[model samples]
Target: MRKMIHSKVVFSPEDLIVVAGISLQMAYKIIKELNHELEEINKKEKKNYIIFRAKIWRKFFRERYYDEKFLTINDLEKKFKIKEWEAKEIRSTIKKELVAKGFKFIKGRIPEKAVLEKIYDYSEEERKNENVSKIVKF
Candidate 1:
């Protein structure tokens, strides 16, 4: 009987065919291309996020305090205790966002007299409906 010793770096004849391999240059190129694509995607995502955030902010503000009489920048600053620049930015962002969302926000002065009444009426109706639902559930 003859004994054969196999080296640690043993390979079959098929191993000489050399399967697919990537060089350093090709790897760098692929990485650079991926990075470029990621940057472009991030820019687009940022723009979309800004546009969506603006729309949401406008909607929430309007729902909470939609004044037909648009609040002036100064009034907004004072009311929110923010800087004049911030107020301007908020108004601009809101206007642009609302326009994008197809909500035409026109600047007009409405009488304050009926606003309070309307708000009270809306609240009362909401409360009544809530109570009715609670009773029905009970």
Candidate 2:
């Protein structure tokens, strides 16, 4: 069997409690919604089983929130063509920047809109060339 990178393929209620700072009751409700969505995927893929009432898929959770989207450190690393450590550092800087700008941010993830706008600045030229953005602090 292939080994997992993070030691977790699914998010348990306890994990949600810690990561999301939500109550256990809310966690269960989130899990239920995740399972329901999984059921839809099951139908499309013809999977035999899709019922996972106790957990939420981590990828799904990362791609979605309520109104805002996020980028995992891994995604940032790939998007910016940077190393993992650099991506992490940039994420930290960006997180602080966003919070100071009055936007809420979850720990260990970067807000997608802020990051893109910061790098691209609403210009295709910047998007084509990211080096001009000066992403590193020191």
Candidate 3:
């Protein structure tokens, strides 16, 4: 006699809620939104299943959350190529500057535009130093 074993691959909405740190209602709402998007794609491409894959959900979440205006610590580290402590220091410095300029600083997120501007200024300084070194060598 031969026995058959079946594997199930399921990602419940609750799992999405937990992973996304959103409410149960929000999880269902996001699922509905994803389903609608999938349906549109399926209709356009004539695909069979109008289902949401885990990979698709992750992409959607990242796109919705991590945009130019708002960035997490990981984004800062990757963009600035800095250690975690350095990233925190940069964030703190920027926040203080913004507060001094009458802007309110939010916790746990840094403004991407401000961080990018700082990075650009730092790069420009480095380029100037390199040019000065070349002139001194000559």
Candidate 4:
């Protein structure tokens, strides 16, 4: 007997293709439908974004052809090479930042693009600080 393994992470089109034994085109169609449903839910909840910012676009493109759509806590831990507690803290911090910026977060999963963006931004900031400190020392 083959034991089935279920993933907690959000499914992308490729995942659908593998799990559902569907063609790429079919998987895309399913993704389109799911996206539409998600939009409707957002609308019903009155969660409208006045601005379609760069961050949102980044998130879209990053997740577009990827295998993981939404990342679970475990995925976050693996991606950042952090402990479970650190993952939770990072997720919470990101959530707070997004909320402050007027974005509504879907519960249970983190946006991969957002996580990547945060890491990139942090590294840039650190580099800038290091440059400033070097100049001061010189």
lDDT of 4 by residue, 1-138 (tens): 422423433445555544434566765665564466446757898865332211122233233332234566888888789899988887788778767765544456666666776767654467799999999999
List RMSD in Å for every model shown: 27.5, 11.9, 12.8, 10.9
Best of the two (2, 4) by lDDT = 2
lDDT of each: 0.40, 0.66, 0.60, 0.57
Candidates 1 and 2 compared: the better one by TM-score is: 2
lDDT of 1 by residue, 35-92 (tens): 4544565697753322221112222223322322345566566665889787666666
Off by over 4 Å in 1: 1-67, 107-138
lDDT of 4: 0.57
Off by over 4 Å in 3: 1-68, 122-138
Error of 3 at 29 (Å): 20
lDDT of 2 by residue, 1-138 (tens): 422233266677777665555578977887787688678878998886546668777666654442134577888888899899988887787777756765545556666766777676664466655655555533
lDDT preference between candidates 1 and 2, better one: 2
Most lDDT-accurate candidate: 2
Relative to the true structure, candidate 3 reaches a TM of 0.39
Q: List the lowest-lDDT window of 10 residues for candidate 4.
A: 49-58
Worst lDDT window (10 residues) for model 3? 2-11
Model 3: per-residue Cα lDDT over 18-92, one tens digit each = 444446666576667666776787899997653754323444444443322555678788876889999888888
Q: Rank the candidates by lDDT, best first.
A: 2, 3, 4, 1
Indicate whether candidate 3 or candidate 4 has the larger lDDT: 3
Q: Report the error of model 1 at residue 22, Å.
A: 69
